[model samples]
Target: MGNQTEVTEFIILGLSNDPQLQIFLFLVFLLVYLITLLSNLVIMVVIRADPHLHTPMYFFLSHLSFVDICYASTVEPKMLVHFLAEHKTISVNSCIAQMFFILQLATTEIFILSAMAYDRYTAICDPLRYMERMSKEICVQLVSGAWAIGFFHALLNTVFALKLHFCGPSQINHFSCELPPLLQLSCTESLTNQVVLLTSAVIFASSSFLLTLISYIHIISTVLRIHSAEGRRKVFSTCSSHLIVVGLFYLTGFLQYTKPSSVSSVVLDEMFSIQYSILTPMLNPIIYSLKNKEVKTAVGKMFQKFKFLK
Candidate 1:
């Protein structure tokens, strides 16, 4: 420990090492980042501009869009820059900050999805009292609570991360400054950090996933009670967008974090990371706008308004 020089910056081994491949990957990821920003911004703008989208569902969707934007923004810009740079390196402080926001925004998104599930449960199971059950105040509280929990969880992990001493290899195998990879490079023991990470994953992430699952179970049961297939389809359509988004998020995230080190590789890690962090944000608005008639209508109206102003 006395002779070890602490690493001040980490060299990120990005997705590709081939110069031509790197340029190609840069173009592809730049396009993805642009779409993520544009699509999420559109979702937010349409929700805000349309009066009909002022309900609890759209309110939650708007926040989800915002989270997706922040989530993608946290990693994509740096990643894009690294893709083209001669030396793909990030300072220790920048890396930690990136990890912090990634954790916070990702955690916040998980809870927000749970809240959306709950909203659907209430809307479908008790339609008459849907508005009352998911009142504006309650919606605000739920969103606020998600953010607060995310902040707390991220801070806890980040504080422990700050205590770690990195005196070993300065090259990160992947593109971003994720906690697990950082732990692998630490000179000091990372048992406590790993324990805290696992504990928080169970407490924050697993709990939220369970809540969402329970909500869907109730929603499905309630839908089954409806007599007509058409009625059931209509009912399911309302929450289908949320369901799809949740599946994409959890599926990729689970594969990324839970996989054994023996089977995990740099390419697989980068692919999973791209899915949940980069591509999912771009896909969310497209899914909602395509699968949801209301959103499509709202977007149409918004475009018409723009044309009218022009």
Candidate 2:
């Protein structure tokens, strides 16, 4: 902490500088955030109310819905406020807290998605032993482990970030206090922090990504062995939504974080950040629910129950 001047707060330069653009963004994002909340809530409710959705896939999906709500809530409220404020600022502690939650939830989501892939693999490849393999006890443990790993990962990032010193010029280029932007603002030697970030990213993000890929590989190979085109189509439909989600998540995440440090672009980074932070959560529920007829029917049934209750 040599020559470390305490930094009290930081300015958050949000998505847009233009007044018109800010207003436009505010409305768009407000609508998007509301939809995210509503859709995820519906997913949870539909899953819980329908015994047909009590399977491992829907169980995992309900948890995923919970995460999507939490993940979006972590970032969007502050971002929405900033769009309307003249000067957007966050205290150092708050920024670190935001980053921590973001990291925790995002990492948890990655694990959840991988777990979902495993569920799908078991369902597709070993339908005979699906129940024996993915029992209720195992599902609980898998989800619990994902949450635990996310918590520790977030704790690690927050702990290391607290060690950094911020002297002045405390303007963050993007809307959030993400690890990379925080590192850019630090006055201290962040070599160790960078190494830790990179290492954790590789261990957490890379491992989960690889697992998903391998699971998908097995799933595809099994699907290809089916002789009937209709049988293949039916099997593929069950997984298409998940595959789309994985592609979007990994694509945006990799674009944002996996780039070489040598290449830096604030605008591009901000765009990609928008994709992962805001867009993905908003899209996930819609994608999963609309694509899966089971979810749609469940939601419809739920609506009918509400009507009867009324």
The predictions' CA RMSDs to the true structure, in order, are 1.0, 1.3
lDDT (Cα, tens digit) per residue for candidate 1, span 104-137: 9989999999999999999888889998999999
TM-score of each model, paired residue for residue:
0.98, 0.97
Candidate 1: list runs displaced more than 4 Å: none
Cand. 1 Cα-lDDT: 0.90
Relative to the unseen true structure, what is the C-alpha lDDT of residue 94 in candidate 1, on a scale of 0 to 100?
Answer: 94
Q: What is the lDDT of residue 41 in candidate 2?
A: 96
Which candidate has the top score in TM-score?
A: 1
Residues 153-270, candidate 2: write the lDDT tens digits.
Answer: 8899789999988987799999888889999999889988888888887789998999999999999999999999999999999999999998888887765666767786888888
Q: lDDT of each structure? A: 0.90, 0.91
Q: What lDDT score is found at residue 299 in candidate 1?
A: 94
